[model samples]
Target: MSRTPPARFTRPRIALLAAGALVAGAAGTAAAANPDTRENAAAAPGCTVDYKVQNQWDTGFTTAVTVTNTGDPAGSWQVEWSFAGNQKITQGWNTQISQSGTAVTAKNVSYNGSLGTGASASFGFNASYSGTNAIPTVFKLNGVTCTTGPGGPGGPTDPPDPTDPPAGARVDNPYQGAKVYVNPEWAAKARSEPGGSRIAGQPTGVWLDRIAAINGVNGGMGLRAHLDEALRQKSDGELVVQLVVYNLPGRDCAALASNGELGPTEIDRYKTAYIDPIAEILADEKYSGLRIVTTVEIDSLPNLVTNTGGRPTATPQCDTMKANGNYVKGVGYALNKLGDVPNVYNYVDAGHHGWIGWDDNFGPSADLFKQAATAEGATVNDVHGFITNTANYSALKEDHFKVTDTVAGKSVRESKWVDWNRYVDELSFAQAFRDKLVSVGFDSGIGMLIDTSRNGWGGTARPTQPGPTTNVDTYVNGGRYDRRIHVGNWCNQSGAGLGERPQTAPASGIDAYVWVKPPGESDGASKEIPNDEGKGFDRMCDPTYEGNPRNGFNMSGALPNAPLSGHWFSAQFQELMKNAYPPLP
Candidate 1:
């Protein structure tokens, strides 16, 4: 059989920085809270503005409130309110507000104090509460009850002993049109400093990921993970991140595989690793505006194609990848439960539908979509929809389905590889996938993303003695897609020709595009012609591939197979981030 290279994948460039990032347009985001709403809540009896939060399961409330006002008259304006005896304000915003079961106290905040009736300010905080919790009854201002009027639309009203706030106090989700990302420790490190600079964190900006490690609640990509940083870093828009949870206990790559471990069990791990992180991060006040969405195979498909667990039984055979029910259980769990996360969302893998052929019906993919949502009892937010641009005015592709003998001869044996010149055609394939995804039942407006991680073909990128020979700057095989589409691990025996990171979604008319995989990482295990050994970073460059001293994870600097060499890989990351988002301001 012709060993045609596999297609590549990508995600928004992960934030890799040497110094901390201010995030893109972070300054504009600090004004996240609406001054008007804060003022609305401030008008109460006794400037002792007390607040309570609800709508939670056991141990799941992280809401708090603060009161502030414009520079008006009135020296001492106290704000106070009475709770129904259920929820408590764990933390205060601009004041030292305290909650003791039902009774609460809202004192003047030292720095942010003084309502003056109109200075244009508000207070917020986080808390942990749950079950049948309601808003306070009476709100007093200046020690004397102001007798708050009927709470208007999007406002809460005070009723006699009213346990709950008025029915119209709920706020809509503000995470629409945002992207979030997740990754493992290696990817995590890459994200912190893409391209030598820290990616900024602004409200409504993206969180490029490094790896998608779905392990456990604490270790998982749950709310507790990066939420606080997202919230504290910026205060506006939505904390949009591209989440790519790649911990399928047993996964398979290179076309198709029956490896079910990477299937359901891996998915279960996703719930804990990926899903739970959102909840954990949301637990912080900063994540109030953060919206998280998973990036499909966001990072290197090492788990899919390269087996860290063991050698593959064979390609296209899913026996190794069939560890779990397609990791469907985990994915289902996340889909059903994502709605509960403060600013969380999802996108099920809608593999480049073009791979299935242009005429394929989006509706027929229903089984996959349905399993993602209802099966796991999750609030399936969206789907990957279309991955390839198989057919389009541009006709794009991420794989080198058409390779030249010259490029192949530089590597291992003779195999039909992807065509670089024709790869961009994959984008056309992606568009078709998009239409099919929409037909299946994705949110009409929920945006989708494309990964430009790699181009699939092994890189003989730069002529080196022991690596895949040739070219100085050809995109790691024209993009990570090359090494991935139909290849094995460690295609980086030398370099992936590392494409300059993309700026946003393919300027080629994509909803959103990002670097799902951390640049400079290993593809697991592979055999390049010239290198004639493992070319992946984790394995090939481990000094173990050619029985050389490439060192283990500690290997640093530019060497063979080490796609993640500290300085060298960091430079690649720098480029990817540059392409993902503009430099942090």
Candidate 2:
């Protein structure tokens, strides 16, 4: 809900106008209205329960529970559950809730208690917990046990639906198999640490033993090795492995650390060398059920918008990238090829809130993504979602704001250039961006994936308490959103902490919040250290370096003399484990 600035872009105005009118007919409304339902009944008469960890901070959390009746019509219903940990339900919605120690009970509200057999109802609550915010295990509808919706029978969990499911309902996540492959390279490196933070009292390595990862194109193990690893992990049933199809011509223009080996002229090589080979293997019939979620380029398109205009600084490579049409062409080529594969889910990179949160940037960014998809011979169906904050840290919530801040004359909330318009945090930015994308011709079912790798670093710098502030600056500095040194700091930041663990059923409008930038993996080194990977060493990683005059940013709070991006840094790992919000398990 961005304010209408004095000068507004015509395209965004038109898009927003259409969006306002069409939003009611959008997909999220239906999905939210009807939680996932099944033809078969639950153990107690086909009641399905979807438990989602909605929002979480350091100690407190909010959860959403959707209970659907797939059996006979019920005049009234009661949902009961027991907390796995020492969880206590403090407040609830959509029902009358009461808690006694570990046991909790919720009777439907007068409007929703009585449900038709196929209809679904949802309610949520806010609660506090000290440690181990595990989801509740057992749920009963009127004393009858309710089966978990999709994750597994063992737990009452709601995994995100991967496909374009009916509105409000998500496709069953592809990563629901017994074991998903976490790149052994990263896991082994972290575990090999003789000493560092310990997980479950064991070394940090134990925690990453079975995590998931993507085999990136530029610096990662090649496609063959990644495919082989997927095959190895796919012992019996389907195997789901995440892969990043980066390394387009003019790979990363704004930053040097990630500049790729490909140049503008190497577009053919990108297709033949990179995307085609990968697509060929993924399309193999033998690997039919293998799910490959490929995050298409990062930092490329945002640079086209933000890096230009001489704001932060523009890059010549980006100019060349646009001129050559390589990025859009390469992305289009990848999507056209990859989309043909049945299991491959292509999520084009949509730079996070910091880059495109404003009204002008938001609409254009959606257009850029659409143009890329169109150039790549992709239909609306070819793409699944747009990933935000890829390999970057952007806060999930905005804790402070004032109604008066929207006033044009008396507002400190406005940045120097872009008006602080509608979005207050990454969540709002994402939800708004999703709507914008749908307006710009993407599918209504298109989901959003946020890379929440290092954003959960809430501390005294970020707002812990809220009250009236002197001005918008105080409101923003002490309250508004995000305590990151700067949103532009993409390198290994000093104070960053681990965000939410990779999860499926995220807040509404988000398909999955993934750890695209695997924790403990470096964003780039501070110094030009030796590395086998063919990544560039930019001065941005060096805390001692002066600054990138073009981007108009200083490397504030960056780790000095660190390892090259993607390498394990034990010190940072220990720091992340130490400051992890919601306390990592």
| Winner by TM-score | 2
Reference-based TM-score, model 1? 0.43
Summarize candidate 2's per-residue lDDT along 324-425 as a digit string, tens digits.
888788888888888777777778888887778766677788888888887756666677778888777777765556433533345644642223555556
- C-alpha displacement of 319 in model 1, angstroms? 3.0
What does candidate 1's lDDT look like per residue over 532-564, in tens digits? 221122333333343222122232222333332
Which 10-residue window of candidate 2 scores lowest in summed lDDT? 17-26
What is the alpha-carbon RMSD of candidate 1 to the true structure? 18.0
RMSD of each: 18.0, 10.4
TM for every model, in the order presented, reads 0.43, 0.70
lDDT score at residue 282, model 2, on the 0-100 scale? 77
Off by over 4 Å in 2: 1-180, 191-239, 309-312, 402-409, 415-421, 459-462, 530-534, 545-555
